[model samples]
Structure formats: C-alpha cells, structure tokens
Target: MLDAGIYEQLSRLVIAMKQKSSQNMAGNRRSVQKGTSAEFSDFREYMPGDDLRRLDWNVYARSERMYIREYFEEKEAVVSVILDTSASMHYGKKSKAELAQDLCAVIAFLTLHHMDRLVLYDSSQMGTPLVVSGGKNALPKVLGWLQARTFSGTETDSFSAVRQMQRRGAGVTVIVSDFLTEAATDPTQDCLEKTMQYLDFTKQRPVLLQTLCAEELRVTMDGTRNLIDMESKEKLRVTMRADVIARYEQELQKLSVRLKKSASAAGGTYILCDSEKERRALILEDLRPLFV
Candidate 1:
C-alpha cells in the first residue's frame, strides 16, 4: 500500500509535470494537453495571430475555405488499473500475493492523487468486473472493495476483462498481473498481441506490469515433492535438484525477456517487479520516471 508521504510526493510529481506541447506531438499519441499536439485534432476558421504554418493549404485550394488547425487542451486523464486475480497469482509466495495487491493499491492511489479519473478492475472472478470510480477521497472505498474480494477459486482470462471494458476515451491502461492463464498456448505472444490490439483500438496508452515471486526465479524447495496447482488443484510429482532448479531459472528468464520485448513492440511501458522489494522502492525506481 502507498504511504501518506510517498503519496504526497507522487501526487505532485505526476500532476505538476508539464503537459506535452501539441504542435510537435504525433497524431493519436498522448500529450500533456488533449488536442494540443500538432497532430491534426480539428480544424477551425482562420483567426488573427493563428500560426500560418498550421493553415490547411489543400483544403483552401480545393474548397476556397480558410481554416487553421485547432488544438484543444486534454482534460483530466482517466487511469484504469486492471488487476489479475487468477488462481496462479495465489500459487506463488504469500508475499507475492500481498505484493500484487500492494501494487494495485499504489498505482490506484497515485492515479487518484493526480486527480484523474481512476477505475479499478479485477478479474479474479470472470464476467463480473468490480469497478469503482472516484477521486482521492474514494481511496478508502477502492481499498475496501479490494479487501472484500474473494477469488472464485477458479482460473480466468485476464485479457477477457480488458476486452469487456469500455474506454470512456483515450487514456492510460495499466495491467497488473502474473500473466499466467489457461487460455494461452504461448503466454507472451498471445497475451501481448491481444492486449496491444485492444489498447490501440481503444486509443488508450498501455502499461504492462508483471509480478513474479522468488520461487519462480530461483527454486528453494528440494527433495521429492508433489507440486499442487493452486487454482486447478492438480498435482505434479517431481524431484528437485540443483540442475532442475537451474533449468527452471533459465526458462523463467527467457519468459521474462520475451514479455519485456513484447511490451516494447506494443508501444508501451513494460516493468518486471520482484515481490520481495519494498513498495516505495518500486514506485520511485520503476514507476516515478515513467510519469514524471
């Protein structure tokens, strides 16, 4: 969870950051102000002091009309934090589950602090998306809703929640998840492609955040054991050893690398978080720079 001190600093840092100039901004890209980017948002009748370079020469020549590009200021951004509550999320360390929840709390708190429209979505239960919208004052309510949630004890599609969500307008969509689901034959490619397409179609910027426990990075268990699937309750018997653990580590690294690359290819921010790190450290080192 976000502390009061860190909250204050993050609030100012994100809200006070200068808006991007529209004149040089690309079309369909996010900027500090809505419609301020030089990307043609709209056209208006030419007025005195209007930049001549912004005049639509083609329109004037074809229709004998005088018009200049008009850039409008973007209003308050809507920040939606999408969380995955899959059974796999519960499979990891207790700290991993707590950290995931903490991650959600921190991001939502920052979004609310910035005075943007903040909506929280969790897919632990399929079909029904728990959404709460409000300002910083509603932080308590959001946290309460999270506390009240009981995962269905079944698995779900994290991306399905994203597809069901309606974009109020173009804004930032942050996905917080373990990215492990039953639907993916290839978790990295399928999840990234589908998510990127959805965000692009909705005209919202994307931010992908993945949380993995230490066990996934480096195995600590040894000897013969029956590994139980937290969600499906299935069992797999295996003998743990140095070589097995090493191979697991190597595979996990490959998965992380692919997810990071996919995030970049989708034109968004990709961050891999260790569940063991302090929340404040994660915010300052990983999150603050992206917004500030």
Candidate 2:
C-alpha cells in the first residue's frame, strides 16, 4: 500500500515544480498547430504560405477559398509509466520491485493531479497494460492493479517493450527498472547501447530513465554465496575473494557510467534511487532534479 502522507507531499511537490519551471506539464507550449480544438488556428491565403499540411482542402474545393486549418492549445499531455515487475526487481534489501511500484504510483498521482492522461504498464511475465485515463479518481484502480501484480520469473525485453510503447504518443515515458538484463559480448557497453536505440526512437519525447535499487551505490556482498539468475533460474556458487570483489565493483561503476552517458546522449534524464531512503527526500532532492 502507498503512504498517504508521502503521496500528498509528492503531489504538492509536482504542482510547485510545474509552477516554478518554464516547462508545463502538458506536451508542448501553446501553438497554432491544427488540432481537435475549438480555437481557430489561423487564416491562410489561397496559396502556399498556408500549410498544404493544414489546408482545408474541402473548403478549397467547395468555396474556392483556400483557408488553412487552425488549432487550439492541447490541454492534456499523455504520461505513460512503464514499471518493471520482473523477478529480478524483487532482489534487494529494500526490494526494488516495491520501490518501482511506489515510484509509479507517485508519478501517476502527480500527472493526474496536473490533469494529464496516465497510462500504466507492467512488463514482467509479459507486457500487460493496466489502465489509461485522465481521471484522478482512477487512483484506486491504478494502485490496485499494481498491488495485485506478482513478481514472476520472466525475462524483460526492454527493447521490444519500448518499441511497442512508442506508438502510444509522445509526452513523458518514465521507465523504472533495475536494468540487469543478460550481458552480451561487450557486457556493459552492448546492453546500454542497444537499449538506448529504443529510447531514442522518434515517437517519444523526454524519456526519463529512473533506475531503482535496494542496494547502495557501492554494493558489498557479505560473503561467498550462490548467485542466481531470477529469470533464468540458473545458479552459480562462487567465493567473494577480495580482488574478485574489487573487480566486480569496478565493473559496476563502469556500468553506471555507461548508463548515464547513454541516457544523456538520448536527451533523457537518468535517476538512480536506493529504495531505503526517505520518500520525501527521494522526490524533492534526488528525483526532482531530473525535471529541472
């Protein structure tokens, strides 16, 4: 269950942030772009200063008056929250899966409070789209859908999921995941580079890559144990030698650097969150900076 006090605080935080920033919660600034609105977009001459793009060809064909179409301000921006509920997300001291859900709930509530449309999806066992709406009252349904979802042993296809979701229209696509997919030949570089292709697709705008974890930035595994792949159900027993642990830490840092670089290159925001922290500070101090 979500904490009511934290939810209320984050809602107010989003409102204040929107008010303070030049950026509006809606997709774009007020424009004369033709859309399904009552406001007149603009008038164009019978000729080409008019966008043949927005030309009322019907009016031109009938009255011989070549008036281009005009549009009104788009009211609501669609904000889609893609939450990763794969079994891998359940492996952490604070439980990454729960943190991902909480983050999703916070974002959904904030977007609805701002009158933006919200679409929620979980890509665990399979890609399951939960709900899409502009109603703040739908919070219960959203929360319930997430609450009822169990972490199953399923592989996450980030590339495929993002590709499919790209058709949902662009606004803000916030992906919350641990991002620990199977490594490739190049391991750190290959996984990130391939994943970034989907994020850079033309359809979506301002992708926010938020990685959640229960472990600290620097992970220190206690002792020798069996490491298992939650999705594949494969296990390996190994001892944590000092030098081996050092190398592991080095690789982890390299992975973080690669992820940050890739996200920046795609013109998106990346946030790393440890689920054990205070929720208020997590939003205000850590996650809020991404919006700015």
Candidate 3:
C-alpha cells in the first residue's frame, strides 16, 4: 500500500517511457517525429516543405543561413506494465507481489499524468490487460485494479506475457517480476532474453525490473529447516551450513550477472530491486536517465 506522502514525492518526477509510437498525439514523451516541445532536439537546414513557423529568424539574421528550429516531438505512447503474480512473488514478508502492486500503481499514475495510454498486464494469466487513461484523477481506480489482482499461479508465463500483447505502438513495455524461473539449461539464456526479443520483434521497447526478497538475497539461516518452494510446494529439509550458504550466494550472484548480460544483448535496461527497500530511490536515481 502506497502512502499519500509517497504520491506527493513521486509527483516531482516523470516516467521515461519508450517513445516509439508512429501515430503521434500530443503528450509529454519526446517522439522521433518533430513536434512542439520546449526541449530542443536539434536544428535542420530549412527545406522547401518545412513549416515556415519553425524557421529560426536569429540564425537567418546572424549567419545568413536558413535553419529550422527542431524540438523533440511530444507524443502519446502505450505504457504497458507486465506484472508477475506467480506464487514465488509472494515468498517474503515484504513480498515481491506487494512491491509490484505499488510499482505498477506509480507507473500507471505517471503514464496517465502525462496523457499516455496505460495498461497493466497480469503475467500469471497472460490474458486481458486493464487499460487506463487520464491524469491523477484515475489513480484510485488504477490502484484498486492493481490491488485486486490475485497471485495464485504456480509460475509465470513470461513468453505469453510478451507474445500475447497487441502491439500498441512503439513505447515502453515494463515487465516487473521476481524472475525466479529455473535456470536455463545453457545458463547463457534466460526467460528475460526471450521476452525482450519478443518485445523487440513487436517494436515495443522492453525494460525489465527484477525484484527479489531481501531474505533471499542476504540469506542468514543458521539451523536445519524445511525449505519450501512456493511455486511447487516441494519441501527439502537440510542443514544450513556455511558451505551451503556460500553456494547459494554464488548462484544468486551468477543469476544477477546473467540477467544483466542478457539485458545488454537485448538492448534493454535491467534493474534489480529489493522488495524490502524503498522502490522510489530506484526509480528516481537509477531510472531517471531513461526518462530523459
């Protein structure tokens, strides 16, 4: 559950969604096509068919050159957030599912505030997505829709989540999940790579936000305990020795490296978040570059 103060805090920032929408409409995101925005993209030599209003009088007067002022085109884009609701997401006291709910809500608000179309997709079902538009006024309904989602599935359908989306123009497609899918056989491949490739094929810019529990990342168990797989309900009773803990940490680190490497190959951004920590910091600090 997000607090009112958090909302106010987020209001200071903006969501940097991928600007790939070919069909342009007025919005905050800078598009490839030139349009009216204060931020200047670059200057192009005046062409015969160029809009006369864009002609730079100062450049013409000073350099005797016909230069046209070009600014980044502001355009509306579809901001589809694919949230994983598998049982593994519910593994911690401050569960990934809980963090995902709040993350999606913030994303929805940012998208709507800037007049971008918003859709929240459930990766667990990989079916209908909740489409929303409007400004801050729509936050309540968006929050309600998000909180209403049930995390019941044993696993996530990452492929279906990306493959099933009806392409809503070139924009950012954010997939938020624990991404705890069993390691790929080759170790060189992961589910995220396949998902990002599908997004690339569909012309949507993909961004992956991988969430893990603090407990999982910083394992501290010291005694023998029954470790249960939330997804399979399979339990294994084993002693938590120093060597076992060391191996687990190594594996987690390897997974992190692989995920980052995969994201680079796919030309997508990979972000890791601890469910117990404040997500706003991640958004405002690490993700601000994309928004620009």
Which candidate has the top score in lDDT?
3
lDDT of 3 by residue, 55-113 (tens): 89999999999977756676577788888888888888788888888778777877887
Task: Mark the regions of model 3 whose C-alpha exceeds 4 Å error after superposition.
Answer: 24-26, 30-74, 183-190, 279-283, 286-290
Task: Provide the lowest-lDDT 10-residue window in model 2.
Answer: 15-24
Q: Among these predicted structures, which one has the highest TM-score?
A: 3
**Range of the 10 consecutive residues with the lowest summed lDDT in candidate 3:** 16-25
Task: Kindly report which residue pairs in candidate 1 clash with one another.
Answer: 20-32, 22-36, 22-37, 22-38, 23-38, 33-74, 34-73, 34-74
Q: Give lDDT tens digits, candidate 2, residues 140-231.
A: 88888888878775867554566566233335667787766654114634655665655556434334444555453555676788988888
Return model 3's CA RMSD, one decimal.
10.2
Candidate 1 lDDT tens digits, 1-292? 5567877766655522222323221232255555544554676677433458778899999999897765565445566677776667765554555677777777777666654656677765434544443467878887787776554446666667787775545567778777655443365347667777777666666777777777775578999999888778899999998898888777667666766765566556768887877778987787653575
Q: Against the true structure, candidate 3 has what lDDT?
A: 0.73
Q: Give the winner by TM-score: 1 or 2.
A: 2
Position 21, candidate 1: lDDT: 26
Pick the winner on lDDT between candidates 2 and 3: 3
TM-score computed on alpha carbons, candidate 1: 0.74
Q: How does each model score on TM-score?
A: 0.74, 0.75, 0.79
Off by over 4 Å in 1: 15-74, 125-134, 182-189
